[model samples]
Target: MTGTEPASGAAHLRWRPAPLAGLRAVAPVLVLLVALLVALAVVDPGFFDPERLLAFLRRSAPLVILAAGQYLVIVSGGFDLSVGAVVTAGVVVAAELFNLAPGLPWLVVVAVLLLGGLLVGVVNGIVSTVFAVPSFIATLGMMLVLQGAVFFWTQGAPRGYLPEDYRMLGRSAVPGAEWLPWAVVVLAVVGVAAVLFMRSDTGRTLVATGDNDVAAGLAGVRVARLRILAFALSGVAAAVAAILVGGFTGVSAQAGSGYEFQAITAVVLGGVALGGGRGSVVAAMAGAFSLQALFTLLTLLGVSGALESAVQGVIVITAVAVGGISWSRRATRTHQPVRESV
Candidate 1:
């Protein structure tokens, strides 16, 4: 037995990723991030202004936060098309609540935000898990419903802007200029929580379920409940994002347009598998920052907004292919850095 222990120890060391492997996983993303920073600095040196960078983070916060939420769902074996709609729903609901009751306090508005998101999540979970609908289909339906409701409520024109105090979440930062935007801070908090969650027993069970539901069930993981929890978390994230977006940008019919796809794109870009069971929340957040940096770079380079979607489409396809097959195989076959799917 003691002799066999030596072989097992050797095997562990052999399989363990090298120190550089960590750097390799993050290298591509880091390179892109750096390239964007360099270009931004070249095109507009003011881009490096502390205030401007903080503002950019504030603006990017919603998408970044949403990407983290989307990561949880995707890594846990589900899709969440409803999040885009939920964002719109949240903004519209908050605005309407205030419009109908102009004297509504900030607390009420915050409550509305939370409640709106909870409802969407519940519906998504019930429909997806209980009705046996695919998450994609389920969320798609929710998106349409929310969109139509917004249209009907606003009649194509939104009213009741969020107050300045409420808007501070998206626009304000810590007291010191050295500190970043509040939105960025919130994102950091959520990101840290997510990372810790991933290290917990429940998180492991959830990942196990994503990897193989049938096997996890036999191992005593409540696969369905975990999936529901994942959806609920996603809905909550959307609500938080809505608060930031609406507060910062104001109420608009187009508030959450295209967010769902973008969140998915960011997740895939971070090397998280679409089908499930493989990813790090930190990497997922990095993917979000990387995407924002890419867009900022593109805009600075004079790329049309219309071209953005096309670029994103290419990214999604390329990222998935890299993570699913090419990079993964490379990561497995050699110590060379693959695509950070690890």
Candidate 2:
């Protein structure tokens, strides 16, 4: 019994996690969110009112969804720079299709937009994985392609209006809580799905691939396929975001412009590793909320809207720098030499 007790104690000690390990993964984003909320409350005492809060969530939903999708790709060791273009394409294509056939059902139009986004993702994956193009370049080229196609199709001017039924997803309120936006429902669904997906085996495998593709492949993980899947998911997310954006803001040639950076920034701010293999989808979503809150605060403070881009640039750079430093410290600790006492 004494021998067994010692063995069990040793095993327990070996298996125990570091005190701060769990907190390290998610604390930054949570702290940022709380801080933002406090600041918002201070800036506008009514910011926490149920109606206003729900409206804020609704406004932030599209970016949150986009961040979720971006999280998948980034955690898989790739970037999806074309997502903004995908959003624009989705909106433009849907509008043009509806213009061509005004009688087309909104559901059908949505399906087409989703498929188009998926197709773009597939191409991105193939180009990056199969053709050996770097993800950054492949997605960038795709962005240009999509932008050019939209410009040609619209001749620099987008036309047609999203049907009321289509707009309802973004603008309508719930039946019982008329003040609550339907977008909250969409955001909830996407958030739950993202959380579940990350907890699944495939998600773990994807993270493994991101951490070290060579090791993951040797362990029988289908790295290429997972990368492609990540990009595809990102594309689908952009499409979903586009639906909400189109419905909420209506269509424009620049409807999705700069959203790619915003999604990336949000993901980084959430503490997701840039080169992949780390971060939580929930944190990434919270990052999105934080970003929106920051923007709102800035607006209230009378910050120029034109400086939004500059602020985003600073956020991205800071997040990346911090992540890099953290990674280096971890790596140093991992590779530090051990000495035996004489």
Candidate 3:
């Protein structure tokens, strides 16, 4: 047993990579984003001008915010098909509320939207986790419910107007900082918070639960609660995105149409695993930017807008397939025994 035997302890202990290793996971998405930006600059150099670039970021903010929320749900091993519907509902509801209460402060409207989003998320969580329903089914049902409600409420078109201040969040610059759009500022805030959250104990536990719920539960992690939190956060993100979209593009029944797929595509593009447990929030947001850049570049090149959805579909399928292969290979390497001479 002593001659060239592998270490017994090495065989017993699971090998884990260094914490810093995870940081590199975002590199690919960042590279892709940079390339897209470069292409955009080549197509329309004016696109890089400070004012135009800021404006571009302003437009990209809603999708970026949605991607952040989707990242939470997807990373927790669940899907939130309701976020797009939530955005539509939020915008329509807010407009209606303002119509009824013309003097309602924008802050009040914000609070209501956030609370509603939270409520929707909790329902999504309870239905999926408590009732043992699959998250995909639960969220899909929620999407239908929201969409129906929006249609009934709006009667095919939004009936109310969003006040200037309310719309400012999506379109205007900070009151005193003319150089910064509110959307950019909000994006910065959300980005910082998400990065910090992912680095925290709770965030790590959430990731662990996504990686392996049984193992995380055994380790004393509250798997259900975390998954619910993921859904709730996703809902809040949808609400915020709704506000931005409403302001940026104005009210319409289809304000958030197709956004769910776009957000998912952005998340996948950022290298986030569809099944969850491995990805960076920064990368997810970068993926959103890259997506927006690609669209802009296409437009500059006279590509038909109808092709956006097709591009997203292709990107999603490719990213997921490549990720599956990469993960399979890594698993194989990780499980292989280390041989050594004693």
lDDT of 1 by residue, 61-158 (tens): 89888987888778777889989889988888888887888777877788778777877887887787778888888899999999998999889888
The CA root-mean-square deviation of candidate 3, after full C-alpha superposition on the true structure, stands at 8.4
Please identify which of the two predictions, 2 or 3, would achieve the higher TM-score against the true structure. Answer: 3
lDDT of 2: 0.81
Q: Provide the overall lDDT of each model, using Cα atoms, as 2-decimal numbers.
A: 0.75, 0.81, 0.82
Looking at model 1, report the run of 10 residues with the lowest lDDT sum: 1-10
lDDT, ranked from best to worst: 3, 2, 1
Q: Estimate each model's TM-score.
A: 0.85, 0.88, 0.89
- Residue runs of model 3 more than 4 Å from their true location after superposition: 1-20, 315-342
- Compared with the true structure, the alpha-carbon lDDT of candidate 3 equals 0.82
- Number of the top-ranking candidate, with TM-score as the measure: 3
Q: Residue 127: error of model 2 in Å?
A: 1.1
